[model samples]
Target: MNHSSDLISGAATAATGTQTTSPEPPPRRRLSRPERERSIVEGAVKFFAEVGFDGDTRELTRRLNVTQSLLFKYFPNKASLVERVYQEVYVGRWNSYWEEIVADRRTSLQERLVRLYTDYAKTALTWDWVRLFMFSGLRGEAINQRYLGFLRSRILEPVAIELRAELGLPGPDRVPLNIQEIELVWGINARIFYFGQRRWIFNVPLESSVEELVQLTIEHFIAGANVLVPRIVQAQIDAAPAHAD
Candidate 1:
């Protein structure tokens, strides 16, 4: 009896069966140029959000399972990549209708503000958005400066103009929006923005719903603005030196 040879043959047969049954991994698909760029930007957004602007591109590529050369092929440099992320996270999410909403005279200023903040929070209060903004600010990146400039011009300045109209104060043409007036609008935005910071960055539990909090904040601002804005403008007027005839 050739028992040893029989055993060797059975082992070989088992190995062959295992190899035949094993599934081969599917081949990687080559993405189109636009598709590749889009993926890199998307991955960078998430990577920067998790680890801030200082996150290494090598680690990012490693996480994405792509070569670093591929990333640079889409983005010339890390700065360009970060810029794309800023556009995607901040500018891309901006609703042009918000400008119209602020300018819409039919809606009361308070309601308009409430709607603006509520909608703004919904769009800008995500984990990626909030964290990336804070990280950029902390790093003194241009992302924060650029976005805040847009906010000041598009939103804060317009809101200040609207508040002047609401309170019967002189328009920007008559009395340019002073820092105090601008800060009043900024305060409202800052409060709403801080809510996002609390929820997303700090990982804190909010005491109330976003809708309730936004409404409450806007209501309080309206109440105070009615009294304070008039007083502030009057104070500014009084502080001005009288011209001698």
Candidate 2:
């Protein structure tokens, strides 16, 4: 036989004799129940943000190297898992200090507003927060409504009261806010909220840091409020029907 044929015959004889095989990959290290559960939750945060609440968990489990039973053991159901996500992303993330700092009487309203927005933007303008917020809004989720109501009661109403004070107008309790004035505060808030969307969602590059953005927003709002609030107040006053003809 030729050298090549002899070599092949020798290899076949060796294969037949030993039945050569490749080693299997090492098994994954086992995680404790708590560690595994926490791992799943964190993974869910990223997964849900990417694919939204409607996205399948099957792929999530596959990526997590876990069985569906294991995920369900910790979360019970997909809805319960989503509730935990809401708790972590929204309910738990809220800083009551935002309302407290804005309500602090020592600082000028402009200073207070700037501080509040700057502090808020630091946490609230992030990818997880912004994307989850947009996702909830698009899904018609109740958490978003609850968050809006909280803002209306806590941040916006307080800011509105301060704006009235700035203009020497009566307090909301004493003079009640018109829809227009309430929406003016909403407009300011919407601008800041949308600024995050522009930066994070639309991939707009902002030259300003969060602090600068907050300051710029406050400056424009204060200047515009100084000019327009007076006019708005006057319009309300002028439109008030004269004493019974």
Candidate 3:
């Protein structure tokens, strides 16, 4: 069995390409899944981490010391493996975290967002394949749509409704935000995802570490949301005077 060095190179190279120094994933926890599935994803993550999303399946099998059929028995195809690995690496823990945060209202919405950023930051530092899919995710429409829902239901929806009631504001009215507000929050999230994940993918400047990015995002959102809410309420009140009978 022989795997090309480019096995983890293709998609990464396709994105920004050609780096001399590369890092490897730390020993992944065995808690990943059943042995067969865990082995498949861990290998897949290594390939994506080393080569990138476009890494060749043929090389993957060679590295796995398995036939294509054997590989497919677990993952089906390259894209399917990428999806499975993505879920195992990034999505699984995150969804579990979602369950915990969703039930807790004692924490502020901003706190929940920061917790998420911090979690991903830690994962990016230790998990190689996770960082790859994060970068690659920006390109997939289906992933993007699902990602939006993940944000809306798990974080934004609960927070928005709570904030609206707390401030004595009409629910999602001109007082503060609408559906578009979720996209604004997504922009902040994109920054956290971009720089953290981009570090391994493009070897971009880590002018700041992962935790710093998460902290900065949390701080900025707190400061900005405060300012944004008032302006929205003012706009509504100013318009109210004209509408009065």
CA lDDT of 174 in candidate 1? 64
Scored by Cα lDDT, where does model 3 land? 0.66
| lDDT of each candidate versus the true structure | 0.89, 0.83, 0.66
Q: What is the lDDT of candidate 1?
A: 0.89
Residue ranges of candidate 3 with Cα displaced over 4 Å: 1-34, 107-113, 124-130, 134-141, 172-177, 205-209, 233-245
Candidate 2, residues 139-227, lDDT tens digits: the string is 87776888788889888878877888878986766456777777877876788888789887899977778788788889888888778
- Report the lDDT of model 1 for residue 210: 95
lDDT of 1 by residue, 1-245 (tens): 87999999889989787544668899989989988888888999999999999999999999899998888888879999998998898999999988989999998999999888898888888899989999999999999889999999999999989998988898878666788878888888889888999998888989999999999999998888898888877877788788899
Residue 87 error for model 1, in Å? Answer: 1.2
Per lDDT, what order, best first? 1, 2, 3
- Native-referenced Cα lDDT, model 2: 0.83
The runs of at least 3 residues in candidate 1 whose Cα sits more than 4 Å from the true structure, single-residue gaps closed, are 1-26, 240-245
Model 2: ten consecutive residues of lowest lDDT:
170-179
Total residue pair clashes for candidate 1: 0
Deviation (Å) of 187 in candidate 1: 0.9
Q: Tell me the lDDT of model 2 at 156.
A: 86
